[model samples]
Target: MSEYFIAVIIGIVEGLTEYLPISSTGHMILVGNMIGFTGEKASVFEVFIQLGAILAVLILYRDKFMDMLRPEKLKLVNYKENGLSLIHVMAAIVPVMGIGYILHKPIKNHLFSTNTVIIGLLLGSIVMLAAEKFAKQHLIDDIDKITVKQAFLVGLFQILSLWPGFSRSGSTISGGLLLGMSRKSAAEFSFIIAVPLMGVACLYDFLKIWKLLSISDLKFFAAGFAVAFVVAYFSIIWLIRFLNKSSLASFAIYRFILAGVSYYYFFIR
Candidate 1:
């Protein structure tokens, strides 16, 4: 297969799993392995395409982004009084940003293996299943009403996603639910928080690999990025609507099946 074709396949996988309770990185690694695309360049490609996914989030939540910039709403006292503000986002992002930066090298070196990803997928699914079953109370119904305490706690939960298959949205949304947030509210907040977190991570990786990119590589990356953007935009919309009416049991079940398949192929076989 051509590099462009491989790019499209990887992009679709990235978009489909990026926001779902499933892990995008895990899917990418699995696909990359099968296609013989694993290496530093492949890792760089994975991070670059996330920018496309984040673009979908920004476009979907353009109103929230604009609200953060309005002159009247810029005041500290009025922050989040109008709607979800940048400050609230920063609160939820700070913990992960700090920890992620400090452990970036270690995580990249030690946890980027197929076995670790399978374990993360299985363990994270268990956490999601348990949180959905046991979390019965919903203290918050709107993303705007999320308290600082709740935001920080959600950030704390995001730390778990440093592992390959433990998804950022899954950990934070599960944390939000366990901390008394409604499903829709938690999902929305999870989406909002992902914007900045992914943006910085993408930028960092781009800088690291910028020197290695060629004209041919640009064409491939463009194809993947555009495909990821289009698919992720629709995926986010569908997921938000789905969360409004359903539990995450199906996602948890899918994760279990993925983990089993991965373990069989990578270890047992």
Candidate 2:
């Protein structure tokens, strides 16, 4: 297959799985390996295409993004009284930024190996399973009621997502539930937090590999990005609506299946 075709496939996987707690990174890696796209080039492509999904979120939530940028909203009284939602989102992003910055090079160069992805998939599945068990017993009724402390703690949990297959959305959403946010709220926050975090990651990877990218490669990248953005916009909307009525247990089960399949392919086969 042409690199462009591979790009399209990667984009579709990224779009569908990015916000679903199914680990877009894991899917991309597995698919890339399956298609014989490996090593640094594939890795960089995976990170860069995430920009497409992040752009989808920004476009879909333009009003929220605009509100977050208003100067007056940054003031103490206004922020505390009316801007708390955006503020909490900002708070949730800080730890990930700090932690990601500190570990970016190490993660990219060393920790992003296939073995780590497998371990992360298995462990992350267990965490999701645990979160589901907890949610069955303790349900939070509202998303807006999420406290700053809770957001920060969720951000802390998001730190785990730095590992491939840990699923940034999954860790953060599960963390939010554990911290008392409703599933809908937790999932929403996870999507919102992804904007800046994934944006930075894409930009960093793009800059790092800029010299190696040809004009043709750029076209392939753009095609992939467009696919991811279009698909992710709808996926985000659908997931939020679905979570309002459905259980995350299905996702937990899916994760278990992914882990089993990955294990079988990597070890049993």
Candidate 3:
């Protein structure tokens, strides 16, 4: 297949899977294999193209980003009163950064294999299903009320995404719900946390493969990034609106089906 065609396919996969709690890294790996883009190039592409999704989040939440950087307006208020959600976000990022730093090479070598992806898909689906069932009984009603303790717990869960199939958004959001954060709140927090995490991942991957990249390769990467950004921006908007009125059960069901199908294709059948 042509490089441009492969780039477009990867771009589509990135846009769809990045925000859906289905593990964008897992999907990209699978798609990369099917499309004859494997090994280090595929890995770097998967991470690098995620900049598109990160940009989507920034554009969608521009106002929140601004508030996070400059909060002098509420300096007189208590920590919780000054829109300190951003600080909690920073706190939540620390564990994953530390863990990821420690395990980066190992994960890239062994944990990113197809078998690991399959297992991640299955296990993450189970977790999502259980979280959905729990949400029905104990729904969190407010996002602003999330405690630092709860944020840290959610961050811990987000660390699970270091595994190929375990989604960053799914684990963190589920953690938020379990900690009594409302679904919308959980989802929002999940989105917010993704910015720094994905940014770092993209940068790490690029630096790793910098010597291998060519100008033509950069063009393809930019094309993929642009496509992903447009799709992911709309997806973020739609997901937020849908979550306002719906349960996370739908995404849970989707994950289960995806996992089952992937297992069938890769192992059983």
Tens digit per residue, CA lDDT, model 3, 138-214: 44565556666777888898888999899988898788777777778888888888998788877877887877777
Clashing pairs in 2: none
Model 3 per-residue lDDT at 132? 72
**Candidate 2: misplaced stretches above 4 Å?**
136-144
**lDDT value for model 1:** 0.89
* Candidate 2 C-alpha lDDT tens digits along 124-225: 888977887785333556545666777788999999888988999989988876776777888877887888777777787778877776676778888888
Error of 1 at 203 (Å): 1.0
Write candidate 1's Cα lDDT for 1-269 as tens digits: 88899989999999999999899988888888878999888887888889899999999999888877788656788675666677778889999999999999999899988888998999899989988988859989988788777899999999999999999889999999999999999998999889989988889878987887777788889999999999999999999899889988899999999989988887888
Task: Report the lDDT of model 3 for residue 182.
Answer: 74
TM of each candidate vs. truth: 0.96, 0.91, 0.92
Model 1 residue 137 lDDT score: 95
Of 1 and 2, the candidate ahead on lDDT is 1
Candidate 3 wrongly placed segments (more than 4 Å) = 73-77, 136-142
